[model samples]
Target chain A: MSNAERPDGWAITSPRSDRVRMIASLSGRSARRKLGMFRAEGPQAVRSLLEHRAADVRELYLTDAGTAANPDLLALAAAAGRRIRRIPEDVLRAMVRSGNDAPAGATGSGADGPVSPQGVLALAAMPEPGLDDVLEGLPHGPLTLLVLHEVQDPGNVGTLIRAADASGAAAVIATAGTADVWAPKTVRSAAGSLFHLPVVTGIDPERLLPALAEHSISALATSGYAAQDLYDAELPERSAWLLGNEGHGLPDAVLQAADLAVRIPLAGSAESLNVAIAATVCLFETMRRRGGGAAR
Target chain B: MSNAERPDGWAITSPRSDRVRMIASLSGRSARRKLGMFRAEGPQAVRSLLEHRAADVRELYLTDAGTAANPDLLALAAAAGRRIRRIPEDVLRAMVRSGNDAPAGATGSGADGPVSPQGVLALAAMPEPGLDDVLEGLPHGPLTLLVLHEVQDPGNVGTLIRAADASGAAAVIATAGTADVWAPKTVRSAAGSLFHLPVVTGIDPERLLPALAEHSISALATSGYAAQDLYDAELPERSAWLLGNEGHGLPDAVLQAADLAVRIPLAGSAESLNVAIAATVCLFETMRRRGGGAAR
Candidate 1:
């Protein structure tokens, strides 16, 4: 069908169609990089894209039920003059399956299942801010940056983004080896926070260090065995907190480059906290120190 | 083979055998209730059970590799005069599969996949502490308790327990609608903290309130929209913090019953924090207030 020929808006029916396959391919890193776009599924993420980053949204796909369920999103997309394609649920499901190897009808509830299709999907241009852009865009207040080094879990990466946003962080820098922040799973877990702040990805540690120094942003590395407690450490007005991988933690070279090492005191017997939880604790501690404790 | 007849110390080879079936059935809440036992899988959980709660361990199932890898656990079980049954990897895999309906030979990496067999399993008597028992066991210092109201995710429940332990909470109380604390997944997520503190499960809200009052412990309920911010709220020295379900925050009855409703201030546009993360933030904030900031 021609782009404007559909009588009742464009409808995609066949899961095996060329367009479906092309959309499905975006799930992979290479495909996303080549296409310079990523998919954001579910109402919340799509709404956030349309509302905050509408200029980046390329296409919107929705099931009939999805359209009915998300009136605000549909209206917002219409207001942005974006095309909306109504797709069958099975076709949407096939798109999700192409990206992930989850069993048919998995619904995203299972532990290893890819995130649920959530009945709506949008293709959007990937945001690729440079490291200099991130450092230069800092607000006038004390800068708080979150630096994630080699953190592998998409959920953890996304949660850190959300936590960073909530803690009033100026930006997030994901160094080499971190999960793709624009990946669908990360987008969903981030809950729209990805659009709120500057996010620079694929940065090397060597490049990241000098930029922080140039900006006078002191970097603090989190370690379970560090002698200095987080509360006791002298947090800088402008600081970057370095978080590491889930299993092995930050490499010694990264820790050595940090301005200081800090630990959260554990009163109980847990060997350690989850990486995301640890970052939240540190981020909020910094916020608390800056008199960010008063609530609205 | 008879229980005492195996020259190799009673090895189970068949997945359908009665012993294997019984051990696998403990994955269900009804089965655990009827059998008065639950399964703990993986080397860490089994080791914790042997080292801390050895008296409650009824049987230890291990593969040849598991036995070799966990000599300290074997010694502890042997010292406790517990029985050990060695099984092949397939039998352990089958036991996990039977309980979780994961595809045959599915090594537990999928979303719905049960935890991997981890080459070890142990059947232990359920630790069913009474509410009175939990209250009485609080340390002489100011008491800190965690009350989970109908929280359903096994991982979240387990993580909360671990966090509670790390924050030095005296005990955890899981109300009727909460996930089974002894489930294999929860046990794995808790990372052995289950044995480090008193955990009381299945207590009704009515019973919990009177117990808290009788102990002179104040209760704080967490709400995302509470008028009082968590930072501004005067957290009691001896208090029980109530966390609600994943989808719904605390029920109105529970909130109305609380001494105060407190919220964590969010500076960004994200709607809310994950339940477990919220609990950790609150618990650690309480710890910081108690001067638990000094690390070893």
Candidate 2:
């Protein structure tokens, strides 16, 4: 609905308002980097931010319908002592559109347009956890750390976060050239696991690998050409899986540096699994071996 | 590049040409149904079709650069005795756009636009395997059959097909309301697995469950609320995993109809795993139990 037709008490209605534009600008990398903030859209992500990292949420915008539909989220934000602004649908749409990197004149919605935020969006401070902090917090026992090397798909990055969280990983690390874990698509696809786990970004693989070894986390990589089968590989007590880019598998240098390279054992004609799928298989295998498969 | 700038060797240059439009029309469900054909975009999918299902391939379209970049695919297609039509980039783009379900005027390219075909597309007959045929052909020993009930995302459907193939399932069955297995996005996300295995579509779960029972294939469903843990469940000799929709999951009736309901045991706060991810975990777990995880 247009802003003019909104009922009373709508705090924001104009899509062109400065506030909306500012939130929209968060869609760009430079803007997010400049502001040290990113946009988290959809009720699931906003709710996650409120639940796990409420202090990081800078501004919360919800449509009247969104508030009505997600009273529990509203309560969580209230409990966090955060102010909630009710916006008109159009304003929310504008904010969502601005965050969308789609070129101008794009008309598709859902399948083609920017993700539908489900009437909720949040501008939150990016959590900048250092590699040292992540390492320090690591448990002495068996643990898994997912390392994405130049993985460019935001969806893959995000889904891997959720998978890691599901498989009970200690943390996720992204090397240089990987998709920003804080990107809107990643946030949505991650389905709020970004809040559940500590994610460190921007480390160079060359440096990250050796640093991980210092922590006793053996680096593991997957390859289609590898002779070692994943099921037979003896996973280390502390493991760091090194996932490569989408189009190219791990670079030779990275693969060479890996402690071990194993194949997932494709039974069919598919050359490989989606990066996330392959990672999950490895992660779950680690979990099962570490006794995570037992009933909690 | 514009069609006018292309060399004269191009067989098709005009996007508006009747032949181009005919192929473009296949993007729509009705058109695909009417023609009994579907378009498989990108070199990976076309290569698989030529390699595994060559007799089903009706038309092959490639660009000059595509031919050079994917000589192996070109060679495979030629070996299949299929005619290769070299089209200009504009024609390829137009065909890609027509297959895209994006609304008119949507300008986004990769992230927003329809998926790029990666320099090759093929028109091929849809493989219509029946449920009984799928069951009859099932291996007498340990086997897996992935069943999708009303799952609607094309990418998820495609990925599940690939996951099932990777996990070495006997076949994949989709219920009514599920995304069309032959859709362009499904074909792409499925990578080449669409041609690797038999997929039977449009079976009612209520009927499908009992039919599988008659064949001694147990029906299993995954749910967050289930009392049974997947890791401990006594997996049947012949298993069929029932996966629900992306949003609603399995209906109560379908869930009740299944022989067993087990949870994947989320370690974190994620309400559930993505349908494809969850399905893969189950498929792989079953594989692991049936000795599929052992080195080939």
Highest DockQ model number: 2
Across A203-255, the per-residue lDDT of candidate 1 in tens digits comes to 99998998899989899998887899988888888899999997789999999
Per-residue CA lDDT of candidate 1, range B10-32, in tens? 47778789888888777777888
DockQ of 1: 0.38
Off by over 4 Å in 2: A1-7, A99-112, A293-296, B1-8, B99-112, B293-296
i-RMS values of the candidates, in order? Answer: 4.4, 3.8
Specify the highest-lDDT model's number. Answer: 2
- At residue B227, what lDDT does model 1 achieve? 93
Stretches of candidate 1 off by over 4 Å are A1-10, A24-27, A98-100, A104-118, A293-296, B1-10, B14-30, B64-71, B98-101, B104-112, B115-118, B293-296
Q: Estimate each model's TM-score.
A: 0.88, 0.93
Collision count of model 1: 6
